[model samples]
Target chain A: MAAKKLNIKDKYRLLTRDLDWDFSYEDPKKAFPYEEFEGIKITDWNKWEDPFRLTMDSYWKYQAEKEKKLYAILDAFSQNNGHLNVVDPRYVNAVKIFLTGVSPLEYQAYQGFAHVGRQFSGVGARVACQMQSLDELRHVQTQIHAMSHYNKFFDGFQEFSHMHDRVWYLSVPRSFFTDARSAGPFEFMIAIGFSFEYVLTNLLFVPFMSGAAHNGDMATVTFGFSAQSDEARHMTLGLEVIKFLLEQHEDNVPIVQKWIDKWFWRGTRLLTIVAMMMDYMLPNKVMSWKEAWEVYFEEAGGALFKDLARYGITMPKYADVIEKEKEHISHQAWWTFYTHGHAAGFHTWIPSDQELDWLSEKYPDTFDKYYRPMWELAKEQEAKGERFYTSGLPQLCQTCQIPMLFTEMDNPNQNSMRDTVFDGERYHFCSDGCCDIFKDEPEKYVQAWLPVHQIFQGNCGGPDVGDILSDYYRMNVGVDNMDIKDSPDEQRWNKWKGVA
Target chain B: MSKVYIALQDNDESRYIVEAIEESNPDATVIHMPAMIRIEQENRLVIERKVVEEKMGRDWDVQELHINLITLGGNVDEDDDQFVLEWKQ
Candidate 1:
């Protein structure tokens, strides 16, 4: 018996890419339908390069380490009265939001990446897709396992899967990803790889890790940090994809330029939720959205755009949109958290006077001038034993499904409004494009499964507010009294508060 | 309209390239293909070797092209006929 050996290039060209063949009697575009719609050209598929020289053995080894680490944390949290260990039941609402808003996106990422693996024209891209698909699946499973520990002690945890599918806020993410999925593969690269991963993933991962660390959530911090480590590689892929497109064809520069404009705006709007969560949800906030933006986007990404200027492109069209909304997004989400948190799995209390001063110092430009008055009103309400919910369902922007808080392009104060008629019923949108999209397919947009509406309709498994909050959202009613728990950590926190 | 093709390492670099191009030409139209960015310029599109050379600096090598690119679409032609950079409109 004899063993045959293949050289590196030979193995790649022969075993991997060389095996692909043009199908007989089928249009190439149909076989690869997404490639031609936007009118970008590709004469040779072989020039693509795979940066990661990964093999199956290496892949499995790394994956196993990730799983072992994650499962251990889940076990510790489950067995050690982890729910009782938290600073407050309100703090657990952050976890509830994670379960409902973000965990499902991981599954969607897995499916989308699987399509990436199978449909990409380049072998390296296929490999990238494979790796990301697996990573996404891991994220989903890990998030579920970690959050499930609180399911016994909290409310809203149970209804997350259902809520994710039907909530107004949830529509933003679902629609955004669906838009990418509907596009050609190259557009997907632009939307997810370039726009989402490269420009914003750092913005996302850093906050998650930093906030978790600040809150003594070692498990979440560890998982987020680990995920961020992998994100760096994905970011590189995004950068490479953009460059390759421009260098590949002089014509491609402009086509990619449009996608950058469109998707950059789209992705930034979608990340409003992240911006709000980072700035508001945590009892111990780390970085303001403004500061994070300056460091991550302004410093790092702004420099990258400067370097890119030589290649004949500009910053995305809606760069100013993200910049302008920084203060408002966090402000609105905090308001939401402060008001609705009691009904959900989390708790919300007035910030200590010290925390208020800290906030003022952190947001010198706007906090004192604009927000302090609002906070004072809230405090007065709390003192009087009255809490406010804005009485009616908010008018969600069709594109982002955030309340229509975004002002005009430059005027951050003047409300932006757009409308479209669907099935002869007029719908208001915060932006023109969103209205247009809804108008194009009225049926799709009209069927939105809004979460607030569900709660009002008494669909969340309870006869009253307390029952629903406990059974569905997963709030702690009995075990530890939320912030004043039986844990040593709570004792220490209480003692520290007494000192000041 | 001329057709071109560019190959790069991944999509992020494709974005950099697109941004670079749009910086110079704001109205430029772009289309995305599986592994490339296709551009259709109403006028001419040029890639000054000196520009790439200057940015890459001492690390510049033609083979590094693979490390730098991820998008290839729209009127792109590079590396003789072996690689097509642009998609024909």
Candidate 2:
């Protein structure tokens, strides 16, 4: 006999809502004592609602379908020798950045969401977090699988697990996720869900995916589009948590706003790599990094804060810094890579004449004024057989752990440097934003895994660049790094174009 | 102001919706965002389910838009077939 079918809302109410208990043995607060540490007061947990109303049955079904679709694309592409059909060899830099900097972060997210799922008091929050945990694990697996095809032929991708932990540029992402994973459940949600996923995910994904699509990387584009589809649900969870907190109690507003301020800046700083990837990395441009900020961050974020003003919340405090820095960030990041990319896995080159013209066209206000002359000089140096590559390790930011490469806001010649001394040990930051983060939590920032500092302290392999590059970084400079013209990738691609 | 606006939380579902809106309303300006997409068009913005289905490459119900719908400005004239946003005379 067939039993009566139930609608999705009823199923969610039964599976998620019906599972909550009014503990008979002890106080509910005592059972979920971890919730009280963050000082967020939730008057009633019933106020929370899953926007998608998904039950476990639907969740498994949906995920299995997506997984099937993903593997099919990967299998077919593998049979076709998809790596050879790429638009340019340089586009693989974007993929390298993703594998090295972004993939391990997904694994971190998996751990984070799993902990939050078990720790949070609310059934709804727990279920959403649990689902997201599974999603993140799927993301990491799928990403590794998608890029594994390239790994068979590529040089730099062979050592992502090692590089993410010990490399200089990669520490920016590693520490960012580590900080979130170690925080309390509520703070983790606000830090990752509300601030990172909800506030600034577009800037991270759009340029990379767009570059993949235009660069003839069908596998990467497929992976990115699939992951981006999941991000919408993650974003909803972010928005829902903030609203649930605000609606539960008025006191939760100020605490939530502080987290928003703190994480917004932190997330923005981590994106400096992406800014360079968008402007200097892509062979075919979708939009400049500056244009992406205006389209994605400013316009969309402005409307959101206006909506949230009803809860007496304000926009991020350091938004002006973001606006002012956008014009210079891509240029600064590219220059840093051009000089110091040998320490890392990816390569860098001076922009071609057409590429430099595109930069000026996209960044008319500042590129010509401040950044172009540096590239022009590099071009002349290349002509004279004097291409510059820095052998000195960069001074690391105590908070973000990136190099101290940002320039002074007004003075082009001076570096934008800030520092503070805690417990007789001096700490340096690249900008006031990073300094503020350090000042708030000296103990936390003090323990950062700064790569350059570790290198100096004889922690990462050894002091010698040769030992460090091969033994520690697992990279061969001439193979992993390139000058475009003399690269094996270029030579291999030339055969297909009949230019060989 | 002779403008109508529609806002949907930026997600996979709404990517198709935004693409559909752009196709139907050529004058509509989409504001890309971190968690949402907002579209503003002069006087009226039409959302055709046909365009959304084509963009998504699947069968899509017009009502599915509400799952990721955040907030919209202008009178929402919604039905099973389509959703139209415009100001009254």
Candidate 3:
């Protein structure tokens, strides 16, 4: 059967215009909120044009191709003994954190995208959202499949579902996403879609891809880059939606600006985990967190905000806070990872001499001052064939779930701490932002999915690290096959570098 | 010289793509508006239909242009004669 040729204009009219229905029971202004936000007058919603020019068939075809390519990489990685070649077993900890922390969020994005596909009035948008929905699902599945290989050698791999519910660290991401989901559709677009996708995801995806590629994890590198190609489309959606809202009204400037301010900070805070993983967790670090921040945020963010300034939005309120924290967020998160390695899905071993030298070169300031001392302590223990552990629970922030190492605003030395008592129980927070979130709804905060609590509950499928590995490495996990530590790629990498 | 219009939903990546295209194709004049981008010049403006199809992994008709347009800042009206791109000043 011959496929019927589809017209672009008709597709546009059918998607955006034809799908919308007037609500007889409620005013359209109240339903849409386009008019009440500010002084913007949409003389015509039809004037909006989605520049990427996507259709349903094209969306599926490209998406399927992306998935096919990603799955092939996963297959090759596992079939070829990928795990043995890892720089160290400890590096698997980073991959585990990624699988547990991020992979599930991809599934959430898939669900959200489905909602967007249905709610968005435009056919083109609906199609695009459908593609994104599928893309997010693919990301979740592929990530789980790729990391499932290390389930044999890692700890903390089994209880992610429970961990996310009870772990203080997860509160950062959980709260951030919950905030977005609770808002009206437009606010969701601005918070998760535009602000995060456009402003921050590249900072994360690019470095992750580069690090995976550099360290000889071919499957991870390929998947990261492939997934990012779709992210470019989302970034465009974010940008277009913001502008569309802005052009729709003059008063939207402030409302939009508030969202940018709120989301940018929220997104930046959640990414401290990424920054640490990129800068400190990788066995072969690419760039310092400070450098990534300067390039991705200071340069790119500075330029972007400057452009938006012409539209009357100022730089976010907490821009300076981010600027100052860039120097230390990596150090703080890595310290937490190191201290909590025994409880984590991955291991944390002391860096080799070569790795130490590399760190000295990458991080001139704190690498020697703060990290070197800790490494020296770990090295002393390693000589005795022992590894370090904190032996107690970390004092987690009531809000962000991060340890209270983040310094006070503009005071890098004084640890930022806020305390509040509810029913005579003291609650600690790293920053007021998180405290405010907790204060707004203590009940929600109390129910956070914390990874630590799950371990105590014995719900992680095992009583010990060895047993947990077996359960988490089940067939459904997909990553059960490839071992990056001993893989051919890692062997080849070691041989090429003359590093045994 | 005739003009080419490009529209971008204002953000970093679309802006980066516009800049990248401009960097690669210097002769093509590019203009940015609040919503999309416009690229215009007479020098054989082609989307490399074969490459696009290969990347997408399927056949696509020329009329499905609006569906693929993720960002549109201005008007790119392709009629019987010339392709027209315009923005409100």
Candidate 4:
């Protein structure tokens, strides 16, 4: 007779428990030095329960199957000229920005998880970190594989890793990841796993994937689907870590709270790119950033934070400030991108009348009042055959690294600017939220790799924007980035459709 | 009562979840849109772990529903084994 099944529940329990052994050879504290520095007190490993009873065997079995299905579809999509079915060249800009900025962060997360997976004292936490490490690596491969398929028919997909390292705008994502990675293991979990994955993941990820679907990008939709279950697990690990830390010691509440506040603000700032992608970059729309913010964050996140209030943790301090910025940040970010996008990878275009009307309808309070006129002016200049890009680099915030493009929350016309002197030098911030964060850890942030500052210091490919684009950014000028009228993707798109 | 509803992104991961939703809530009407899939039921929609597990041939947790979840309506009533959406919490 065949052996009885090692049923899922019992198997997970045994597998997780079997790893525990008496550490007579070395003191556990001496063995794991990184666990105690963050001041988190964990009394019992049993307090950490993995909501998903995943084990090694099942993990392997499930992941193997996903890769199989993913590659099969990727092959079919590539062979059939999937690029032709894509909605428009404008939509592919979303894909380009995603590939250039976000895909590398996946690789960064892979490294972060590897460190924590090794350093955590609790087996449950270690196992979760290990799985997350694997998940991040999986995301790295999957996103690049999907993006590489587009490279066959598109520009700007090359040199993504190099671009992420040196480009001016790429610093937003670079700093967001490295800040989390440089912290102690527990703080890293809070910074990324909880605040990033649990609180902010929906806002950044959902719209891009949905926008991909709307635009006939099947590979991107598949990338989103393939990672969904793993993302659910990552979020659970984050939530569970907070609960475990809180339950272990009363003092841990505030430390975790502070991390939540810092990371939430950081997460919001990092998502400025995603906000721009959703609202402006995608050719076919999903929903406005305002609506996505309302549905994904305001409603869902309200419930989540309320659930956590039982632990004596309230919401992040500047939560209301985020609500105010939502109506304005996407438009503000797009304008900056519109002017500087040529120096970067993708082309930026003036919104057609219909698109401008949609922006006005969606952003009724702010668009016409502030942004529509600017686009109208850009169009007017273009009508007379004048093209545009930022003549000089704008001032970047010390903490968030975003240029001082965001407007005052109450007064939409004025740039929401703040600055403070650390040591002897004055540092600029985009808003009160960023200024507050800078004051919290002035030293950690003063060391920030501000791209604009680096450029002026003559570290970036000399003084000329031409040298900066080609020598520094690898931009192919008119072919890689320009108006949608004569850009390479648009030309390819026209040629493909011209056949029909 | 208004229709009990949920929407998930359109992708391979959701196929099993959508199948499980259809299995548990027989009257569920699945609507396919660009990059998103929506489902509606008469007065209730149930997501059963047993059904999802059966579809994937592995264990599933109700929390896993969040991975594919775009938006869900009605009040959510959830437990370790199953999650149900109905008019009242």
Candidate 5:
């Protein structure tokens, strides 16, 4: 009789588990040094189940196929002048923000996963992280390639990597990743692999990808599809990691819970940018930020937490606050960028009358009452040739690094600011959640590279915002940082489309 | 009985999987939204590897369903043959 063929499970075990060597000369503890530092107990590495039965050979084969398909679409898009096919010139600002603000996070994810991939004792986890690290690298590359065509025409697409490191608002995302990467391997898994990839990834990818499709951005939409295929493996790894840790020992439950709370709050704060993009940036909107939050977070996350409850895990702390903030953050974040348009890397403008009405309809209880009046005042100022730009810099939350733009959830007019002293220095936060996160680790947050603080300390090039914008952040001043109404971007678009 | 659901991106790849699912679980309700397709069933939902392979006219690995999976609810029991989702009592 012929020998039985090896199944996928057997092949995966051989490729992953069988590759691990028994430590003889060196201690395993010294090898995987970061494993136990985060208070997570992993009693047995053998209990770690491989989430996806994929060998390195199959992974390369699949990714190569995806890259082939993605590059073909990107080529077609460039050859066909896909930039002109968008719904409106304003739509490109969303892509600008994405390329600058979000793509760099993919690179950070790659570095993070690669680092943790080396630190985990479980071969299954190491293989999983190694695969996700590659996935993130591919995502960033494809994202850059997809947007490179737009860079030929758009103003703000340049200097994204430089701006990611030095810009004021870009620090919000940068610090989030740096914080995760700085943690021990177990916390890194919970912070990124589980909390971010499993719980919050849909909120990030689905809206942006769907927004791309709705707005006729073929290159971006194609890349979104390509990256999403890899997201499944990442997400399954996230789920598996959490389950393995939770089931290993009862003590790990609280540690994992605290991480879920911390990362969940941080993830929501980072997604405020996404909320603004969905509500204001996309000319052909996919859905209101509030609606997307409901579908993605409230309903879907609710179901996930229900399953997690069996392991003594409840819904994340402050989920109610996040629910309320969904109704408010998008409006508030847009207003912040609008007032500070001169400092922002992307163009900002008062929403059209139709958009204001849409906001009122979607946010029936709050928009007309609180937000519409503010837009009306801005419109009045613009009509009077006194287009509003706040000269003074706003205070930023030490934890989230977002300018303290968010309002009190209960009172839309009241700022939800909190402050506490650590080591004889006063630290401020935007909300109770942020304040708590800071207090939990004051030493880590006190070292935050706050842009506003750096500028005030004579560290960011010069005194004037324009000097810093151009010299330090590499923004092109008037060309890159202003309203879309009369900027070079708009003018060029009009000239190309013959809108005389 | 509580409902279990799985959402997949609305694309050509998922259409075959969705067809196989609908045929297998006759009581499942399929809802199509913008850029996404959701299938929900009370108590349990199953996706058989053989059925999807038959529908696609090619060999299909159970793990390939995740290529388009957006999100899912309930406890999951997956293997080489089939993927099952249900609420644990």
Candidate 6:
């Protein structure tokens, strides 16, 4: 009789876990020093399950297939001038935000995972992190390649990596990853692997990808599908990591909870940009940010947290605040960007009359009440050859690094600002959530590379905002940064379509 | 009893899986959203490897289900031949 074939489980065990050796000469503690420092006790590495039973050979095979399929579509998109097919030139600004504001974070995730992949004593976790690190690297590469076609036809795409580092708003995402990468391995796992990949990724990807599809950007939509295929593995690993940490020892619960609270708040803040993109930037809207939040977070996350309740983890802190902010954040974020259009990497504009009506329909209680008036006034100003741009730099949250644009959930009229004196210096936060996070780690936050502060201190090359825009931020003055109404991007689109 | 669900991105790959799921779980209701397809069943839902393979007209790895999976609720019991989702009693 022929020998029975080895099943996937045994194959995975032999290929992955069996390869880990007993540390005889070098102390295992010396090998994985970061594990104990985070106060997460893993009593048994043996209990850690491989979330998906993908061995490296099969991982490469599947990923290769996805790459092949994705590249074919991307090549087709480029050859066919996919940039011209989008719903409007306004839609490309969303892609600009994504490439500049979001893509480098993928690179950061790669570095973060690659770092943690080495630090874990548990071979299962190390291998999981390694795979996710590769996925992040691939995601960044594919995202750039997918958007590269647009770079040829667009302006803001030129200085994405540079802008991510120096641009004021881009720091929100930049600092988020930096904070995660600098933490201990376990904290990194919870901050990114679990809280980000599992809890918040849908909010980021789904809206953007769906918006891409709705707006006829086939390259982005295809890449979104390809990246999302990898995301399943990342998401499962996130779930397994949290479960393993919680199940290992009772002491880990509170530490994990604290990380959850901090990262969840940070994740929400980081997603404010995505919320703005979903609501304001997409000419052909998929759904309002409020609706997406309701489905992805309130319904799906609610269920997941309910399941987590068994592990003594409840829904993250400030759930009520987050739920309420969904109705308000997109409007607030777009208004800030609209006012600061001259300083932004991408073009911004007042939403069309139809878009304003859509906002009113979507945000029944708040849109017509608070935000529409501002847009109307901006419209009137634009009509009279007096477009508005805020001359002074806004103060950024010390923790989240977002401009203090968000309002109190209860009182939408009032800016939700909080502050604390740390080491005899006052640091401001955008909300109670960010303020609490800052207070928890004042030493970490005090060292934040706030762009406005850097400009004031002359660390940024700026006697004038123009000098800063060109020399420091590398944004092309009058070309890359401004309203889409009469911008070159708009002119080019009209010329291509033979529209006056 | 509360419902259990699995959401998959609405695409070609998931169409076969959703069909397989519809055949396998008769009580389940499938709802299509903007870019996602959600299948909800009372208390339990299962995806059989054999059923998916038949619907796909090829060999199917149960792990491939993750390619388009958006989110899922309930306790999971997964292996090579079958993937089952249900709450603990």
lDDT of model 4 at residue A187?
92
Model 5: lDDT of residue B8: 85
Model 3 DockQ vs. reference: 0.07
Best by TM-score: 6
lDDT of 2 at A189: 94
Best by DockQ: 6
Candidate 3 local Cα displacement, residue A130, angstroms: 3.5
lDDT of each: 0.61, 0.80, 0.62, 0.81, 0.88, 0.88
Higher-ranked by lDDT: 2 or 5: 5
Native-vs-model 2 lDDT?
0.80
lDDT of 3 by residue, A1-500 (tens): 89875555556556666766667898665554433343434455565666556556566776776677668867888888676666654465567667767777787778777775666544545666677788788887877777776554444466665555434455567666766766556677788788788768867776665666667676666566666667766776776677777877787788788778777877888899998788766777766677768756775556556556657878887688788777678767766666665444444445668877877787776578656777888778756866566675666676566667787655555788898877677788787766765776687667655444555677766675445444532322213223234444345446755786
Query: 2 or 3, which is superior by lDDT?
Result: 2
Interface RMSD of each: 13.8, 8.5, 10.3, 6.0, 3.0, 2.9
Q: Write the per-residue lDDT of candidate 6 for residues A1-500, one digit (tens) a residue.
A: 99998777887898677999989999999998888987888888988787467888878887887888889989999999988899889999989998998889999999999999999988888888999999999999999999999999989999899999999899899999999999999999999988898868877876678788889899888888678778767877887888899999999999999999999999999999899999998898878999989877887677778778888998889998998899899999999999999998889998989999999999999999999999989989988999999889898899999999999887999998899998999989999999999999889989999999999999999899999999999999999998988899989999999999
Off by over 4 Å in 2: A1-4, A26-31, A495-498, B1-89
Q: A344-425, model 4: which lDDT tens digit per residue?
A: 6887888888888999999999899999999988988888888667688889999889888988787889998899999999
DockQ of each: 0.03, 0.12, 0.07, 0.22, 0.39, 0.41
Spell out the clash pairs found in candidate 5: none
**Candidate 6 wrongly placed segments (more than 4 Å):** A1-3, B1-11, B33-36, B66-76, B86-89
Task: Pull out the clashing pairs in model 6.
Answer: none
When summed lDDT is taken over every stretch of 10 residues in candidate 1 chain A, the lowest stretch is: A479-488
lDDT of 5 by residue, A1-500 (tens): 99997777887889777898889999988998888878888899888886457788778877887788789889999999999999899889988888988899999999999999999888888898999999999999999999999999989998999999999999999999999999998898899988888767777777667888888898887787678778767776887888899999999999999999999999999999999999998887778999989877887677777778889999999999998888898999999999999999999999999999899999998899889998999999999999999978889999999999888887889988999998999999998999999999998999999999999999999878889999999999999988998899999999999996
lDDT tens string, model 6, B1-89?
54677878788989999999999999899988667777998779999999999999999988777667766665566778988887543
Q: Which one wins by lDDT: 1 or 2?
A: 2
Cα-based lDDT at residue A279, candidate 1: 63
Tell me the tens digit of each residue's lDDT in model 2 across A1-500.
89878765677888777988778988877877778888999888888887567678877866676678678989988999998878778888788889999988889999999998988888999999999999899889999999999888767898899888877788899999999888888889988988888757767765567567777888887677667656766776887888789988998998998889889988888888889888988888878899888866786566567667778889998898788888898899889888875665876788888999999999988899999999989888888997877768888888888788887767756889998999998899998888988898898878898887788888877658878888887777677865655666567667767884
TM-score values for chain B across all models: 0.42, 0.92, 0.41, 0.93, 0.98, 0.97
Of the true interface contacts, the fraction found in model 3 is 0.00
Candidate 1 residue A288 C-alpha distance from true site, Å:
1.7
